[model samples]
Target: MSRAFRIQVSEGVQRIVHVEDGVQGTIDVLPILAPERMAELLATELEKRGYTRTDQDGELVLVKVGEGNVTVEVNVRTGTVTVSIAEEVQVNVSTTASGTAENIEDARKQAEDRAMRQLEAAVVPLQEAARREATARLEAELAEVRPELDAVVNAATAEALVEKARELGDIESIEGSAEDGNLTIKVRV
Candidate 1:
């Protein structure tokens, strides 16, 4: 573990800090300030503003007690942290009608709200699947089966090839597709 250093925001007051991990005695100064300290200060400021941290149902606990745009998320399982930098987006969907103006405007507004809700519902699942796939790709890689392939190739005959295929696991069946001629091996893997 490395020593934690307090970043000087002002003369003596520190706004951000970082954990210095490297040599036994030397400090590793981050070019960028510590994200955790920013999160803490933001959380404190939010507390001052009368907002409180609350459980975000079952997805993840989001700490939204910040005064401004910064939002922090602390995962209960792994104790992992995430920060969200947000911006407000204004959407306007307006329509002009000749007769029955009130009904038309009300219908349009309702339709717009429903569309936004539907979009959110669909996008959330897609985003979750994408995140899962990305994480899996980053963390897992296919093992090289070349050596296993070589063992199977060195088999004396067709029957031995089928046995080798079965030993590799995940193989449903191995069949000689062609009558003779080098045996067109069909591998179900």
Candidate 2:
């Protein structure tokens, strides 16, 4: 069986955008880090690293986007962000019954098949252990990659905020950072 990891991003673009000049500015202005765009950027990054975007959704957002399994959700009123990516692997387990054929050769073959099936059942634990190891290895890689990912995202978010600020009115400065899985942006409106 083939194994793959699916990535999901929820609760993105969590920032407070105050329109000081609502009369002069566009009435409807959304954050730069929209959930759809967030998912696109993330998928682009993952694809560059060799993770094919599949059409099967993992365990996050209930909605499906395009044909891929990855889901990106956006909420303007949410303070919590959720991201989940999981690979689903199915294992077949079954035991065969002994044959009652009179022929010795047929009976022997049937017995062997049953024995092999029993062996397969017994080795299920080993398969689970290996799966756990694979998951742990992926988590370790995530810990190492998170910092760099955050750096890129942080820079992008800051740029978007500054751009937005300039678009609205006379903005003094823009500052942003990513910590504890939250993107915090402060703009001087």
TM for every model, in the order presented, reads: 0.23, 0.38
lDDT of 1 by residue, 31-61 (tens): 1223443333334433443435555655333
Which regions of candidate 1 fall more than 4 Å away from where they truly are?
1-102, 141-189
Model 2 clash number = 6
Least well predicted 10-residue stretch by lDDT in candidate 1: 18-27
Residue 102, candidate 1: how far off, in angstroms? 6.3
Provide the overall lDDT of each model, using Cα atoms, as 2-decimal numbers.
0.36, 0.41
In candidate 1, list every pair of residues with a backbone clash.
none
What does candidate 2's lDDT look like per residue over 1-189, in tens digits? 543332221211122221111001111223575655545544454444344444433422222221122222222122112223344444444444454445656665666666566656555664565456545654454454446445445544544555555666676543334334344344455
What lDDT, from 0 to 1, does candidate 1 have?
0.36
Q: How many residue pairs clash in each candidate?
A: 0, 6
